[model samples]
Target chain A: SQTIHQWPATLVQPVGSPLSLECTVEGTSNPNLYWYRQAAGRGLQLLFYSVGIGQISSEVPQNLSASRPQDRQFILSSKKLLLSDSGFYLCAWSTTLNYGYTFGSGTRLTVV
Target chain B: AQTVTQSQPEMSVQEAETVTLSCTYDTSENNYYLFWYKQPPSRQMILVIRQEAYKQQNATENRFSVNFQKAAKSFSLKISDSQLGDTAMYFCAFLGDSNYQLIWGAGTKLIIKP
Candidate 1:
């Protein structure tokens, strides 16, 4: 079975600080990876998606960026964080033809 | 562009009762997919059910079922004998056969009172 792992389950970062959240998937290769953010009571907002290594498509212009350094490893980073950047971040993966996405446990970021 | 819509912002039902959450979507393509995902307090996305546009029969998984109306563009989820654990935010999603991207709706929060 395939599984996704996201780390620093909960993060507290000071304003203007650097941010890095890592996500890795095991048991799958060449999977489509995505990054999503959810506000307190709002719907999920797709931030970025990667089809292959070094290939990323960003959905929104914001303080965050994503990279697929390795086939199974995806990272979300920011040079300087903003207060508005605080929210729950989720990483998901799906097969080339599959319609459903399998999501990781999510990282809760609190920028103070 | 495809769009998903969940009309109910919140719904509450007593334990052991039945509840149906409504979801509708708009798309120009004929072949696509529909899905329901559940997010609990832990914020983990769980797949509830899925329906393919080409299939005429609705999909069912144990106590969970989906009513797929392709012409109406409606796909509703029905939870039988709801439990407290069923309380969560449900999101409706649409995926076209050509694109790997999924369009999600603003979720409907379901609360099951015990």
Candidate 2:
């Protein structure tokens, strides 16, 4: 039984401001964590993924960056937010490559 | 590189009817996994069905089933006796052993009318 928690449920940030979205998994050890962004009417876009602590693989180059400081903790951050950065950010976890992912309730970011 | 495609952007079906959502993928890997995920208005994504490339039998879960054509690189999902609760965004994804990233398709919005 594993659960992923992502917050804050919704966020409103000013342009050029910093951003930090946190995701943590409970009830699983050494799980693979991922960060995805879904723009309106678009599919999920992979931003970053981590197989273990202190290991991060970025899928695309963007204004965002990810860090896995702990086994169950994955963080997505940005030093300067852009207007295009506004979207629904999701966090997901999976035990293996063959299985499906369990996603957390996404964070709606509105960069005005 | 692996890519998934869901052509239908939106579809509607009456309650109690059957609906099939089409999905096609392109991949060079012989061994991989395909999955269908459902995201309700609440935005909680859940796995509807999965098919392993090595298996010939199509995978089915309750009222949900998959038509896996490995050679054709097509994997479609069939929802039987659709309910209003079935209204959601359905996504197709592909995963291979070479990459941990799951390649996703542009989702199809399925609306089950009452």
C-alpha RMSD for every candidate: 0.7, 0.9
lDDT, candidate 2, residue A64?
94
Compared with the true structure, what per-residue lDDT tens digits does model 1 show for residues B1-114? 899999999999999999999999999999999999999988899998899999999999999999999999999999999999999999999999998788999999999998
lDDT of each: 0.94, 0.94
Residue B4 alpha-carbon offset, candidate 2, angstroms: 1.0
Q: What range of 10 consecutive residues in model 2 chain B has the weakest lDDT sum? A: B41-50
Scored on chain A only, each candidate's TM-score is: 0.97, 0.98
Reproduced native contacts, each prediction? 0.78, 0.78
Query: Model 1, residue A110: what's the lDDT?
Result: 99
Q: What is the DockQ score, from 0 to 1, of model 1? A: 0.78
Residue B67 of model 1: what lDDT? 93
Off by over 4 Å in 2: none
The DockQ-derived docking category for candidate 2 is high
Error of 2 at A38 (Å): 0.2
Candidate 2 lDDT by residue in tens digits, B1-114: 678999999999999999999999999999999999999987878888888999999999999999999989999999999999999999999998677889999999999988
